[model samples]
Target chain A: MFENLLTWLDSPQTLQAIVVTGSLLLFGIGFYGLLAYTRIIKILISLSIMESALFVFFLGLASDPHKTAPILGDLFKNFEKMNDPVPQAAILTAIVISLATMSLGISFAIEYYKRTGKNDIAQMDALGEKR
Target chain B: MTGFITLFTLLSMSVVALFSLRQSNLTQSVVLFSGVGLGSVVLFFIFNAPDVALTEAVIGSGITAVVLLIGIRHMHKEPEIEEVMMENRRGIRRIAIALLVLLTLLLLGKTLLGALSVETSNAGQALLEHAMQAGAANAVTSVVTYFRGFDTLGEVAVLFLAATGVGLLLTVEKGEDAIYIEPNFILRIGSGFLFPLILLFGLYIIVHGHLSPGGGFQGGVVIAAAFLLLFLTRRRFGLSHKIVTILESGAGMAYVLLGLTGLWLMGLFLGNFLPHPAEKIGMLVSGGIIPIIYILIGIKVGSEISYVVEKLIKRSHDV
Candidate 1:
């Protein structure tokens, strides 16, 4: 049973599952931090963790076991059709949007730091109370 | 086969997750973050989106890391990390986000459930069959141009919006610049070689867009990346700002003008007014307006991205 499990783990299908599993783990940590963590910056990091995990999960779902890069040439010549390019297009769009998000997130971090000199959500709340 | 892997994967993933979750420090969490990015990059490849995988590899791993590192460095100085022990966690917010996501997924799934196969898809089969007539070798390119040029035009609008918004927000705020701008020998050397290489590749991607997988957006981003290399190297590369602005506006203006000109010449807006003679698919002059549109998109995207980054950096003087 142990040997079977190890062998299975080595397979691409298993590898993909493992990837999603890691992503889920990330999502959990991020979700917990986003909710329970008291620091604003830490929460942001947690959110990022969650974001990356979801990214992995989505990408993993897009992969096919016997597929190759959707490029044209010798490999593609033998194939009936290339794998769906829609996911690639969609993910490419997502990547760009994520950059914008990060840029905006960091900007907010800077602003938050400037205003509070503290990056904690709890501390931020105290300041909010002060105001 | 898939079931066993899925089960095992879930098990292994939980172990990794537990490790990350049990970790006491914020720094460890961030380090673990990259692991997730790498895992996803692999998944993207599996999904047959090498283009997406490449983008994820570059931006998700590269630029995202840079942003996070900067954020973390600043965050370390603050005592806020230890101060939070709130009674109420944002469970409500989480539920709301989840519900919204579920709704979106359900809607999307429903929409796709009844979708036609590629063979029966009107746009897909038409482009595949009549691609030669459209002057585009690639069916995708044919669809993008003759069928969906309007969407490409809208994408240009979005790029312009990003540039404009960032430009307006920054307004060339004064601050110490050179001290803030990170520089390195490798960045200089690699950038020097890489920019032109990337630019060359972008042109190839755009020019040959009709024949292959790449298109205006991908090629345009590459061109912007080339410009980014200059920004990293030259610090004050004095990027002929006016020329870039002109190019950006000109490309967009030209697209509209091209469309309007078609209306004048062919008595229809965006009409194939000057459609190049569709002699042979995949040839230089083939794909009539596809190549021209791509070229315009490359210019527009390159300029807009550069403009956005420049605006965000605030053009502060070195202290």
Candidate 2:
């Protein structure tokens, strides 16, 4: 049993499995936050957490233990044994785009708070029937 | 050895994410959220994605946390007391919902891990094979600027729209009160000493993008960070909105014009038209149009984010 566990730990797939489980748990945490929190900032934070989980999952899965980074340098002469560059590039774009959206959401929340004097989403009843 | 490190980082990240969400204090939560970003940076490095790691360190960990804290500063502090009260009154239904979500996610993750093979796709392999033809040493940079250039253009457009939206939403009239905090003497002196170095480092990252790990987006965020430091440290300092707008617009137009030039010259949008001799690969000046495009992107992203930051802080309105 100990030998079996050792073999499992040595395999590259072990890292991938850990990443998958961890990111899923992180996503769940974000989901819980989104459902439990009423503040706009908290919701935004939850959304960003969800996004980060997805980014981690994507990059972690695409990575290979045997290969080096895709940059051809003095040490790495070519792309023969390099991790996939496409996902990294795509995730890079996604990170910037997510930052843009997060900031935009924050700006909207700030404006809403300034106008309504309320920061909680549950309290945003400006269009509802008067109490 | 790497496996153990990865396991530890992931575990810590999970803990940090949980704590950040559970924390009642808004400021503490924001700081803990940045800790999560820090953990991801380490994970990205371990995963052999140095480019993505750099970008995350700059934009995800650094700028996003700053933006969140500034956003918190913009709001009145009294609402948080009500938030704390709401936290206490959370019903059992919320816990039940959270448990349900957790169970569903676990099931989904299990199925996903089983179905997805641990290998690169055929498309990715093909990109890797031809990535060198773009004349950049960093395959990710080549893929981002040369192969998937159109998507990046659209991304820049999205950032522009977001920045414009923030500006519109947060535009303070002349009579409106602006946020002003007394500058710390230490921070003021330190930022003055650090500003030029940060700008220089941002330029190095942007310029060396084709030969190294960083590129326009990461370098751009670093540049904006320098401006952020100025905003935080210096009391009456504000960016000239007109100048920033001009710089952003000009850089964006130049990017498109470069693409048009590629199309006109080689019949492919963003095609590498300049001479990029294969022997010269890995050299700083070897990537021809790739480095130029990255430089333009760096400028555009830097100016756009700076503009957004200025709008968020309401400092430019006075200027």
Candidate 3:
């Protein structure tokens, strides 16, 4: 039974399923944190978590069993054997852009914290009260 | 084996994320977030993208944590750990949110699973076949700096604007009498020793970008990390804002100018206008205009991030 289970786990299809499920689990946890947390920074962190979860999902989605990196390095030269570079490139751009967004969000959070001495989203209902 | 490793990594990262969220202390949260970055670095490697791995390691793990710590330090007070009343912990709200999140996750997972079998697009296949014509060993670099050079240009601008926004938000008159925590003797000495090595490594990464797994962004962030280390240990060491600004803009202009030159010569913006031996692959000088553009990117990104780090560290004291 243990040997059978090991064989089941070894399949590429099973691995892809595990990765996809794991990424979704991460996304769920991040969403839960976003809902549960009131602090502005905590929400930002949760947002970052969600971003990472999507990244994992994207990279995992493009993963293939026999293919290698797209680089034309010493041992690898054939284009046929190369993994898809499009997703990798897109992910590269995504990572940096997300960093920019994260920094900007943090800056706004810091400014907000300074002005109101409060980081909790629930308490920040100035607009609601005015309405 | 790769699958097992990835499973372990993803599991650990999720645990770290959860733990970080649970922590009330700001510094602890930053540290745990860095742990998540480190785990993602492993994942990037497992995915066979070393460039992304390097960027994730340097920018995601190193400089981000340092900047956050600096921000935390400047805030003066400890982060508020709000007490929750039993009545405020609405069970209905919790259940609703959980159910919503589960549904979303299920949808995303199913869609992604469906996407797994899709074949590579014709454009992607063409890019794979003809990537060598650009004379870049790393196809990702070619895609980033050559095919999507315009996007990279825009990304750099975004980074520059972010630094500007951070400076605008955090601006305060330089605190002449700012308290400097005198670092321990070991830390000071170790940082001093490690600083040059880190800088050298960063430069090596930038220069060998075409031949290897790292490029401008990774190298620049690593360089910034080195500067951050120095800033932490030696509080008196000042970064001139004017110099950093000049470097940032100078490199940005150089990148644009290179692109324009490509357009002028080759009749295409950011085209391989510069003379390079396309047949000779893996050589440092092989990739036409790619190496130069990456170097420019390295300088721009390095200065911009370092400037941001310095601003966060210096101005956080005022607020």
Comparing 1 with 2 on lDDT, the higher-scoring candidate is 2
Share of real interface contacts recovered by each model?
Answer: 0.35, 0.57, 0.30
Query: Candidate 1 lDDT, tens digit per residue, B1-319?
Result: 4434444444454455445444556567556555556655655655556566666665666555555655665455747335455545556547745764565455435434433112211223333444445666554455555556676576667657656655554443354332245667776778788877988987787777766666666677667667666765775564566798799999999988877876798786666666566555546676567778778877887677666555444434221
Tens digit of lDDT per residue, candidate 3, span B1-319?
6777778898999899989888877678889988888888898888877777777777677766665665565555543556222345467448956786677567547644665543333446678887878888898888889988998899889888998898788765766324367899999999999999999999999998888888898888889889888777887786876788788889998899889988998898998986766568888788888999999999998888787777666664332
Q: Sorted by DockQ, highest first, which candidate order results?
A: 2, 3, 1
Q: List model 2 lDDT by residue over B177-270, tens digit each.
A: 4566677788778889999999999999999999999989999999999998887677677888789878899999999999999999999999
User: Can you write out model 3's per-residue Cα lDDT over A1-131, one digit (the tens) per residue?
Assistant: 86676666556666676677778777766776776777666677788788888888887767564577778777866556777777788887787767767666777766776777665666665455630
User: What lDDT, from 0 to 1, does candidate 1 have?
Assistant: 0.59
Docking class of 1: acceptable
User: Pairs clashing in candidate 3?
Assistant: none
Provide C-alpha RMSD values for all models, in order: 6.5, 2.6, 3.1
The weakest ten consecutive residues by lDDT in model 1 chain B span B114-123
Docking quality band of candidate 2, CAPRI definitions: medium
The better candidate by lDDT, 1 or 3, is 3
Query: How many clashing pairs in candidate 2?
Result: 0
Best-fitting candidate, scored by TM-score = 2
* Model 2 residue pairs with clashes: none
